[model samples]
Target chain A: MDKEFFRETLSYKIITFLKDQIAEKVDLTVYIFKILVKVIKDILNLRVGMKHILNQAARFGVDSLPLALIIVGVSGMIIALQVTSEMVKQGAVDYIGTLISLVIVREIAPIMGSFAIISMVGSSMAAEIATMKVTEQVDAISVSGVDPVTYLITPRVVAGFFIMPSVIVVATFVGLFGGYFPVHNIADIGLSSYLDSVWLGLYEKDIWVELLKAAVFGTLISLVCASIGYKARGGAIDVGVATTNAVVYSFIVIVITDFLISYAFFY
Target chain B: MIKFEHVSKKYDDKVVLNDLSFTVDAGETLAIVGFSGTGKSTALKIISGLVEPDLGSVHLDSRNMSMVFQYSALFDSLNIYENVAFAFHERDDLKNKYTESQIMQIVSEKLRLVGLQNIEDLMPSELSGGMQKRVSFARAIVTNPKIILYDEPTAGLDPVSSTVIEDYIIRLKEELKAASIVVTHQMSTIKRTADRVIMLYEGKIVWQGTPAELLEAKDPYAHQFVYAKREGPMKTTAEAR
Candidate 1:
């Protein structure tokens, strides 16, 4: 009788916890969906100012450049080194460039580039909007009859959506170059042979696929961060908390989205 | 002119405002006084549409209304000049409204009116608390709004700073000629700025009178609140209901 009671109590707790989590997730999804709708409406109405868009683009593209390059470059070199070392043991060293090119183009470059953007640009966006909320700057804009979403959010989303794919293209190239260094020296592949392998491994479909992933990842990062930040209340500490949540949630969503997109396209 | 009719608001069943009704005509200042958590700030928020009343309605014929927050809610990213000129810059729909030079002139004049000078480049973080509040004042009046709401504008200020703010309230009352509502706990502010006073107790207006009449009101709640007495009809629990 005691064991049965305990089991029933534990099951009840678990069910209640699950229900709460689902409710929280649904709330977050609805919030992000509302922001997405506002962004779309602002775009259609031409509510976004070009100057703000350019400023945000510069922030996402220019400020994010060094981090994207460093991460993708290091990841590319590490992948090439690890893969080439194994290929040497198997006497399949000639295929080092082909394997590195395929992995870098299809996965590593886009993911690492997105991580850089989510950490650098998305976190800053969240912190900024969160600070605005706590300071009542968001309220000030609203009371002025200005749509805070249009004035504050739409530009960043549009900039991220448009610029991230270009950043990813650059990251992919830098990553390939990084891979080239290890393969050419350690695996003794000539530059021309490496180029030929890369060419053979990359399909035109992969380019479009990677671009689409970047776009989706970029939109998710900005929308999640901005929405969370804008909705935040209380004081300065809340701003910091919102920013941390933005980073964590953005990274999780980006990875999940990448998986979904890959499955849809590749499956 | 603005009016709140039969407005009721609650935060999770604890009533903040209950069946409250009030109005402020143009060119008048209405002061709302209450103890902390008595919905003074919430009432202002409801009028500004920052918050919604759970029941009843708010009628505002004027579209141009501004609220000066207790903490002065200035945009931290923008410096003092830009913060004050924000609304002016946003009026792009008005053809031949004002040139950049004219806007700058007006911003300078407003800043000067708030007793700030030559610090337009300074960010909100760099300013003292009092200065930030004054900057918020400049921003609020720069648009020449028809209805202005001051939420604890004198909160966290020194005596002198409070006087300066009161002076602005009086001066701008005549200068801008806008309807103003001040939510504050300070009786001095009520005496100096208010033409009509409403005392909130237990989410309802327990007393309504002019500032002079406030001191002589016979209600236990009003007596206890105005004199800051430790014990009175202002119960600490819901048992009063």
Candidate 2:
């Protein structure tokens, strides 16, 4: 009777829920770290295939380029549209390019580009691996004496690390152009003034920081998604669940890491 | 040779296999027959090292073992040639030994051994289910494995297709002279491919004998299984659940 009463209490339920959530998070973190360590070891040993790495790089970087550019570009345009007229009214027309370029380079482009990638490439990677897990392709690979981590996850993580910075570089340029269109048409700013403002406001450190953030975000997204997918069991429904978790977890990790990196560099 | 000694496995609170012991000599095929969820596939996985038993040991004379999964489990991203040649390309001991041209020749020969010819460029998705199973067979023997495990090799196939797969199972056994385990409930599969049979229930083997003894024996479980009777000592997965 005492046990039943305790179980019926709201506090008990809440505690149980918290415990379950914490356990799951801990498990996920451990799995991700294990995969990261294996991937690093495989990379150091040159166990990862170059062909597989290039193939994944093409998929993650080249294939995701157009969508990433469009997302970042639209975000840049929206920011410029909302701020340009107001800044001009305050006699701050010269600062429009500076503010817009600063935001685009330091924050907007990397985040939005990663968001696009998490949706497209990361989710697909999760689903593909989850399907393999369910169908026993992963087991077959293991039985064949090949490490699934080296065969499947290493190439993807390596590709993400190397290719994402390139994607961000292109997205950053496109975002600048996107902001320029809105600023020119709405605030009647000259190209030379806007260019001068952008030139003055942006520093070399910002570009390097952006690239660093992109590389980190890319690696985290791939690793987290693949780890989640590798943990999938059961059947088709579990595959779907794994894919959704991959996307959600990648988004959360990227956001938190972005804040931490930004705080460390600029604070 | 393959040996399983005092193996036990459980998932969460449910026991799947309990104190199971078995052996298959080199060049012999053993069939594990049971209803779904009785640990037939689990036994195969335990032998292949895909699943670790909770308590016991699996002894294999050689480390070279291959598992042909129920659904073929071919890598969708690769063509038929790549799929068959996967071990040569991926396995550490074999990857550096074979040149690309040598791999191509071995893959072609293996595919032809399974009665498939010149379809190496097609993807797994393009093949029929039976053809995919054959390709998986080709892949399984590509490494010249000493122990081969098949999880429902004839499952989800038409009668003709099932016969074809059974034929290949016997043929591969003859060719490789390897110890083999086939997990299945199909009577035809047991009779045609399995040299000896074991019937599992409630995490234990309830009966074992040659295929002839399996058919003629009056053991309640084997009787129920061979006749497909609704009333018997054995329970269906739904009833067990």
Candidate 3:
């Protein structure tokens, strides 16, 4: 009876669940770190194939650009619509562009751009790799005496690391442009006034920080998504699970990393 | 030759292969037969280095080997030509060794060897299952490997397709004179291609003999498997429960 009670108790169940979750998280972190090390080694050794990198670059950056612009543009307009009226009421019209530019550059563009890519490019990468793993395509690559990391992963990671900033740079400009409509219409601010205020608020440090954040987010998304996909087993169901986990984990990591980076830079 | 000495593997608490040992000599084909979940494919994976055994070692006379996967496993992104020529173009050691013209010639020759011709530009998704399997076969031999492994080479195919694949297996064995391990359940594949056969159950070889012996032998495991009988020493999951 005592054994049954201990096993069936809510507290026991909670503890067991927590333990399993922590163990899974730890295992995943170790796997991702190992993959990252391998990817870096392959990149440094120049073992990563150039053609593959260029192909992945087109998929990750070029193909994802239009959607990223739309998402960032919408987000920028939303932020402007919400804040411009209040700032104008407070007679802080001059600071309107500053607020919008800072928020777009530091926060909205990177985070929203990452979300867009995670939805489009990152999920597809995960699903593709997960399918490969399940179908023994990965095994075939391994049997051919080719390093799967160099062949499958390094290219994606390298593309993500290098192409993400370009995506964010494009997204940043689109977002800033998106803010223009609301500020001009709602607050009656002229284009030149808005442009001047945007220029005044911008600093070289902010641009560098934005680029750095975009690069980190890009690497993190690709690495985390691919690592999860590579570890997937089973069939179609497992592939679906892997894709979901990739997107969810990417979102969580991006938010957490964004917070950490913001605190480091601004605080 | 390929040798497995006291190999054992497990996933979590379930023992898939326990103290398994076997050997396949050069120019010979060894068929690994088993019911589902009996570690037939796991044994092949261990040999191909796709999976490591928990306890034991696999010895190979040559590290140059290729595996033809169950589903063909051709890279979907690459065309039939690229799929067959993958090892030559992608492997670091071989990529620079062949010129484009040489690679093209080799790819065409391999595709022809598999009875496939002039379909190089088609994607894997466009190929039939048997054609895909043959292309994978061509890819496997692209490196001129001294060891070749096939995991269910004739699975999910029509009878005619299976026979074609079986014939190619024999032809490849004759041409490469390589050590080959075939994991399969089909009796035709066994009778047609295997020089020796080993039956696995519960992670151990329950029977070992030639194809003729496998058919006539009074071994219960072999008999039940060969006849596909419901009443046998091997129990299904429901029967076990």
Candidate 4:
């Protein structure tokens, strides 16, 4: 081998191979980062888009409200018991009320509420957009004297962000009560501390945190779900794949972001 | 009326359609024909604004248009009635738009027109392939569209379903007096529904004429495509036709 090619003492072949690996790794990082940025940008756009979907979906309010309530109630009951059990074992049973309050109001309720919304509204958004995408319904909307963003995205993102907070607020109360009932019915924890430890010491920041989390979580959920549907290609199978990816990505982002946000808030 | 002026479309540097120009007169049917990848659907999509043309402008005077997808674009979460009603429910700044009752009536009428009135309560899942197509068609027409674009309306359907969809297209032309644009691989659909036919090949409109003219065109690509032959200038997977 020429000195120019071999003088580095690393074989040219191995060096070239390493270079290729780095290039691939860099490309993958960019791709993943692009997706993450898209998710973030769409979430930011949610302030407007989600409102429209919520307004439209709300017209059939008789259907959407009860659906929201049932999901909130069920998730609340299950989460309250499980988390309190863990806290109890740590000799932190008294903190159970406070911890439950934080989890439900600040994190669990918002995330799960967004989950329920995604299951109902997010999936629908994907199916709608995917169907529109393949069938050209979205195209129809675009050509018909209207911008698809205003017609589609604006409404959906709006609905997601707006409705999420409302649903989360309700879900938070339900989740705390979910914990309260178990603490009363099963743990036999008295009502005095439950009320005092949970509701009595409520800080303005806690409320702010809850609302902020709800709003952000809600907006993110819609943005991620609708954008996934918006970018989806191929046929029904592609839609299915997009839906799955949207859910998995949104949940993963939510968990990571929630932890990070919580750390920033408390630490 | 809609016009495509020297339109070209590319995806990731792969030119799917190139340098095509055509016009659809107000309230007229224009059928596009081509072998797959000759960019027939892409042409339709270009005009419909589903896919932007990389190098042309599609101009239309009418602001209200609808597309009937080959697979039907009904929302799965919606029942048949809501799916049909979505056109009316869509928010727009237009004045004197279809009222809710008016929209419902139109939905019922379109459902009746498509022979799917009995299944208004069904979700998209509950409908058969043919029924789904019918529901999709109703949703399109329920908007009272000035232009209706159909992408492979008869694709993957039984002859009976094909004829049903074709008949509805013809009826929409005669009764609703709507302009129709159809892209299809099914020659029978073209023959039955298209008032005028255009063929795309290698991104160009290789042929354009009435149905009779299309049937008699001596162009090798048109002949290969309309006749569903695997021989001639049209490229197949394993060979050129």
Question: How far out, in Å, is residue B183 in model 3?
Answer: 1.1
* Proportion of true inter-chain contacts also present in candidate 3: 0.84
Q: Model 3 segments beyond 4 Å from truth?
A: A1-11
- Cα displacement (angstroms), candidate 4, residue B153, comes to 1.9
lDDT by candidate, in order shown: 0.88, 0.93, 0.93, 0.72
Candidate 4 to truth, TM: 0.73
Provide fnat values for all models in the order shown.
0.56, 0.88, 0.84, 0.47
Give the per-residue lDDT of model 4 (tens digit) for B115-167.
86678787888879999998888877776788778888889999998998899
Looking at model 3, give its docking quality level: high
Residue-pair clash count for candidate 3: 0
The candidates' DockQ values read 0.64, 0.84, 0.85, 0.35
Worst 10 residues of 3 chain A by lDDT: A3-12
- Candidate 2, residues A130-169, lDDT tens digits: the string is 9999988999899888999999999999999999999989
TM-score of each: 0.94, 0.96, 0.97, 0.73
RMSD of each: 2.2, 2.3, 2.1, 6.5
Q: Where does the lowest 10-residue lDDT sum fall in candidate 1 chain A?
A: A92-101
lDDT of 3 by residue, A126-191 (tens): 999999999889988999989888898899998999999999999999999899999999999898
